[model samples]
Target: MKINDYLSHEELKRLISALLVVLGFISIAAFFGFTVVPGLRYQAYTTGESQVQAVQGETGWLDPTEYPVMAKEVIPPIDPKTVMTPNPALMARGKALFAQNCATCHGPEGLGDGAAGKGLTPHPRNFTANAGWKNGTKLEDIYKTLDEGIKGSSMVSYNYLPKKDRMALAHVVQSLGAFDHGASDPKALANLEKLFASAGEVIPNRIPVSRAVTVLCREYAEAHPQPTATTLR
Candidate 1:
């Protein structure tokens, strides 16, 4: 009953073979559960028609106004030869404008690291650091930015400003001493002069208040066709 009674070799072999079969089945089941099945489920979830339907439904009723206009106009070069000298008076005004509108994100010194700038994701431009994203030392580039803001960024159009005022602000920005282009390239200066000269002539005139008022009254009358005379008065 001692050693020989433990198990016959053939009996032990049969028991081991049965155990191997059970282990193989468990391994196969585990592989399918952990990898194949989950992958298939994920593919079905992502590639199903329901995904397209959900996207369509979400965007179908979007208003036209919800989409931003991405159009950009061609910009003219800043005439370096005709570059007006920095006017201290205009710079003072520009500084006030900067404080009122830009100081929140661009610091009081135009360093682009104001108090509010800290929370922004991409961060603001540090003007004092001399790292301009839209390059060119010409004042025209700065004017273009002020007129038609940089896209995909927080910079916005300041088109409400008069042309002269915008030019003044550009000068003030340049006066920060970061920009130091010596002189306008001779070729660029000649080209700018030619462009300006070839441009259509603009007539300067002032309409009388009486005539302007009449035109406005006529427009209002046309819009509200049946309005009483008292409404116009």
Candidate 2:
């Protein structure tokens, strides 16, 4: 029998219709499995994990207060006896250093009223007043301040200064009438002297302000001296 003769048209149509229905069901199942099911599962898993972590308090965030605070280093005191023999040379060097590095904020007389001082809060310490907020008038205290800066203040560490130079600066600061408003304290002076001695050899005079002054005076006198008149009889 021929194929067309054996199969009836109505029967063939029914078979085709059944095959299409099965393919349609397979396509719908495939779309759900590849797209919708995975997305729903992921959302549910993530939400559940987040909720569990919140309930357990296991979010892994650290508290700031858990860290320990460290204390500042303390500096040693100096012997007063050795630093009293005022080294004019060191003072002069320190004066120059102050002019270059400190005058802008501390003023020419260290009054803490320089042009820049107008803008600063808790205005720069008036060294002339010698009101040391950090306390301890020891030379080491000054040196430590120069080595390690004070926080929340304009006072910064001048670690770049050599030990001798720092000592000179301390001495210069001390000499500014701030440390000696009345009679010099014998003990304090002696301790300062000893501190200077311990800091190795004294700083030598390097600046020549006097020589410059002398030259200027000689030039001025030669150019504009008062004339002595000889009267003709």
Candidate 3:
């Protein structure tokens, strides 16, 4: 028998029914695409971006410049020499700051065993050990690390911190440095002297963190202005 003759009437009927069902689905989809979807898209086009933003503004959309800046703290004067001094008061302040911020990653003792620090690749610094740290353990190096964290690491920039807070944290980190051997290398102390003697300006910590972020953004923009695209001939 020929292929068509071999098929039973029931089989042919079922096949034709399946084809009709598929065609009905396609027709429904095409109708929705041309009509229903267009209606939805039309609603979106009716509102301009500015108009939408205006509505959002009424609903409490605020500009960054308008955000409430926190009250500034009156930070005491500190020079580079004072920074390295083993002041009990400074160490106490640093400890508090570390507990608030650094302890999350660096642990309570600055040992890099914080619960949050766990699972980070290359592991966090063990302040007790001070191994595999990118920045040296000197006062200036710690200050630099606080200002700009180690690149390609879990460390983040703490420059947003008030200058005094950063300095205090640096002192805390420096204090954590415990040499495995007898004494620190002379070269390290020499490096600290070279950097700390004139460690630029020790900015007052009167400004709050919120304001500091804005200031840093402005400074960065000034330093690295984007180049305008040139038209190709």
Q: How close is every model to the real structure, measured as TM-score? A: 0.43, 0.41, 0.47
Clashes of 3: 0
- In model 2, where is the ten-residue run with the lowest total lDDT? 41-50
Mind giving the per-residue lDDT tens digits that candidate 1 earns over 134-187? Answer: 645566666667667667555656554434445566776666646663455666
- Give a tens-digit lDDT track for model 2, residues 88-138: 665766666666456666777888877756676667777767566463445
lDDT of 3 at 92: 70
lDDT of each: 0.48, 0.49, 0.53
lDDT of candidate model 3 versus the reference: 0.53
Better of 1 and 2 by TM-score: 1
lDDT of candidate 1 at residue 186, scale 0 to 100: 60
Q: Model 3, 168-206: lDDT tens per residue?
A: 677787777676423445676465545545444332223
* Poorest lDDT segment (10 consecutive residues) of candidate 1: 55-64
> Which candidate should be chosen as best, given TM-score against the real structure?
3
lDDT of residue 216 for candidate 3: 54
Q: What's the lDDT for residue 67 in model 2? A: 14
